[model samples]
Target: MRKTVIVQDSPPSVRLVQVGTEQAGQRIDNFLLRLCKGVPKSHIYKAIRSGEVRVNKGRTSADYRVEEGDTVRIPPIRLPRADEPRPVPPASFPVIYEDDAMLVINKPAGVAVHGGSGVSFGVIEQLRAARPQAPFLELAHRLDRETSGLLIIAKKRKALVALHDMMREGGGRKHYQALVVGDWVNDRQHIRLPLLKWLTAAGERRVRVDAQGKAAHTIITMQKRYGRYSLVGAELRTGRTHQIRVHLASSGHPIVGDDKYGSDEVRAHFARLGLERMFLHAGRLELPHPLSGEPLRLEAPLPPACLKILDYLEQHS
Candidate 1:
């Protein structure tokens, strides 16, 4: 028998893809990044800018969100063999709620919502791998890697769009539990600070309170006092990045285990007492169901490690 070896490096010709409900709601650049597995982002943008890529036979901007049934023309691009996407391992999390439209899970601390910024894969990728037959699954919002609790995943295009609109209009409630350093005075206080996102000299992302920044508001209520530390409930009115953390820090009480905006001495002391991660948990959420518009409330209790830290604080206080 003669051996026949096939070469897999041939560049594909231009193709037109009709966007489906499962692939809708994402920007054009992002859609190309996924469709062209090994193509560089610069090439994707260049193609979009030069009219090589088109939607409905017309050039479209990179930020344009693809809709269902829209035909996207993808230009041929050579892919290096080594740059192919690696296999994503299938994984699952503790499901708090699940319907045909959406999935809510009790996400743990230190696990990212999606893969990027040096992370190979995250919750969304892993869940997709785990449920290979799933038509659509996308993150409706985001939580910091160090924050643990209820996270929502949209399983349908309608649900994703509805959730995004609800978040933009502040139609729902998002509550978090935080253990912060300092003896907070007010029983309840609203911090209306403007925050601007900037990058450090080393290219690290950081947020700071600035007069010319976006409006950020957080309602803080004193839950308990532990001498030098205070347990507080944070209700977000504006969904800015690191809004809760920066607000609490500006009030002279950074989250206990937060490395970015916390005091070294305070964090070290808490570390000695078994506080392993940032003391921020998305403990509760209330919103209307995306499809049905019915009232819905979701909750995730403190994990074992967080409970242990609370126990120590209570005992010491």
Candidate 2:
């Protein structure tokens, strides 16, 4: 059963018998934990810590004093797991931006950009399946499986060829936002590192900065600071495989939650801080329209999970 109460100086009335509790003196968190046994403890603690649970229509700490006959307002509980499956479209992507030659989408993380070895379903394939009448869509760029952001797709072969030419000629720009370890001493710095592409022990493609590698450069500026970590804005001068991650790692500050270049100790530290994935995102992109030659800019906001972690750090630290 659910209960609601209005905020007033007088304590609201709660019928303890309704919730199978006639006892008092239990802490609010403890009582709620008992009342909602199926919910994750972490989530309950989070809500309590965030002041979402209140006692007597007033904000109370998790350890607040509880008396008999006191009223409590329990916010609607959010289930840990999804309750319904995502709606899958019969045809192509939900286009966020479109013009005569190019299309953009809020590409979800965990979906590959193109088909590879054993994978048959990728963004391209799904688009084709949904829009059989349109010719095959071409990728203007690629994003890793764990990254989410605006993605550009070319509708015509000529458009793809032209975009590729522009990128090769250093006519395109890309910017990323990353939560990295360590407090940057300088407000802005440039990383000029060469990257060599190689396969990992598990046969996954990876890149590292080496003397003999292809040239890569990125400019980084500090956006915000949270104790040992800082949110940074990265502008790419040249596109290379894992360029931002490699350059930042080489500079002695790997991105937080980065499993590839960061050590296990660093990963564990971030985990303890409640980060579940690599603290990196493709924040924005800028380029000329493939056919019209007009400039276009696209931006994506940080995901809620990422922001939640940041908020925790800020409040606790």
lDDT of each: 0.87, 0.72
Error of 2 at 98 (Å): 1.1
**Which candidate leads the pack in TM-score?**
1
Candidate 1: give the clashing pairs: none
Which has the greatest lDDT? 1
Residues 253-306 of candidate 1 have per-residue lDDT tens digits of 999889899888877887788777899999999999999998999999999888
Worst 10 residues of 1 by lDDT: 1-10
Point out where model 1 deviates above 4 Å.
1-11, 33-52, 57-59, 76-86
Backbone clash pairs for candidate 2 read 91-130, 92-130
Model 2 misplaced regions, further than 4 Å: 1-94, 268-274
Please give, for residues 115-201, the per-residue lDDT of candidate 2 as tens digits.
554554568656755665653366788877666677888876568778888888888788888888888777999899889999978
